[model samples]
Target: MASYECNRDFPVEIIPSSCARHSIKCRKIIVEKIRRDRISNSIEELRTLLQTNQTNQCPEQPSARLEKADILEMAVQFLREQASSKSNESYQSGFSHCLQETLRHLSLHAPLQPAEREQIKRFYVHQRTSMHTRLSTEPRAQFCMPSKRHSTLRVRKSLWRPW
Candidate 1:
């Protein structure tokens, strides 16, 4: 049977031979480098320990945070792919139109804080303007235009419009 030490010390040289060739002071350099490396390694080890402890203490799913992050990232990538794949004029126009509609829908239903509400309002206005521009450029696209009532109504009234 072989015995193994979990925490083994390794010899590390902090000063390079080039420092001696340049006649630079080596002792202080060596001490400082060693200290810096020690502190860095300690911090990394502490972080690993903390992460391990957190995982071990949790009774629920181990990778919930990672999974959520992955899902969000995947959704973003899917949106990007869809946007990038629309090379044709009609596809680009239609995609923008649909995006504007989705944003408008989200603004109506999503629970938003005051600041978030302001941000959403700004985005909605911008998207509406972009939608108008796209519709102006391509008048034949029926689905891209806001309905008569929706186009005339104020934002508040538009919010009340049935889904």
Candidate 2:
């Protein structure tokens, strides 16, 4: 039987080629087991996350057993919902800032009666409320900017007075 021995070892045991091949196979199996363990641990962690972050649990079976595929699908859906909510919040914040600036400009520069100013304020408030409601109700709500003709600040010549 052909044997291999390490020169570095003080007490070298003759290792047959068959034994060497078997050792290599054992190492491969150990490595594969470690890889599988890591994957299993990761999936377990994901399962815990899905359980904790479940806001709208199913009414039928809230504590039902979830398959790996179900957990993954729910995680994807949760992440997408989170992303959409964040984007909508950002959009609403920007819209609010613009509305405030517009209102401030009108109050400072535009010559209008108290009733007219109140009317304009109410109109904008209504629009903002409607937008918020729509965004909350619709999963895929799209915001379209007003046309250029409608969006531009057109101060009537009569309303503008240089004091």
Candidate 3:
């Protein structure tokens, strides 16, 4: 095999020897070394990858220094954080929703007449207790999960006063 030009896209320069086979052999060895070196073994490589991912789209194919296990671990941690954040958000939303309903009902009634006020208070207290109990007893992983539908109720107000 006669010596030929190497592909312009290759990052490392393979010495253009008289024989193309020798150049190809050298390139293969270089790639092999890169693959054998894990990102965990080199702090610099890990930093560079983290920076690249944070800044922009990485090149079409990154260096083989990034191990499959490292990538999988990162993905798992990200999903865990996402789940925890979602649980907190759902819990807050449910609590706020219960409060909002209670307030809206009371507001519409204006000044409640004692018995009616007591009834509304009891209803709100029951909802609050149920929410608190569920939040406390549920597993951390399952805490504060939203319903499958993920829908919110919209409130429309005050079109009665002639826009």
lDDT of each: 0.49, 0.62, 0.53
Ranking by TM-score: 2, 3, 1
Model 2 misses residue 74 by how many Å?
Answer: 1.2
Candidates arranged by lDDT, highest first: 2, 3, 1
What is candidate 2's CA lDDT for residue 49?
75
The superposed Cα distance between candidate 3 and the true structure at residue 126, in angstroms, equals: 4.0
| Sliding window of 10 residues with minimal summed lDDT for model 3 | 151-160
lDDT of 3 by residue, 1-163 (tens): 4535566554454534433676677799898888777544554555465436533433444445545555544444435646755775596588678777877787797966889767877877886676566444432222122222221211022111334
Q: Each prediction's Cα RMSD?
A: 20.6, 12.2, 14.7
Error of 3 at 85 (Å): 4.0
* Candidate that beats the other on TM-score, 1 or 2, i.e. the better one: 2
Q: For candidate 2, lDDT tens digit of each residue in 1-163?
A: 3333434443444445556766777789899999999988887888887665542342233555678877766667566657867977897788788978887887789777889888988987886887677655443211111123422332132132337
Comparing 1 and 3 on lDDT, the stronger one? 3
* Candidate 2: clashing pairs of residues: none
Better of 2 and 3 by lDDT: 2
User: For residues 1-163, could you state the per-residue lDDT of candidate 1 as single tens digits?
Assistant: 2222223242234234433433445566788999999976765555454346434544353533333343344334434434534533465477568866876787789855789767867876776676557534432221122244433443343232235
Best by TM-score: 2
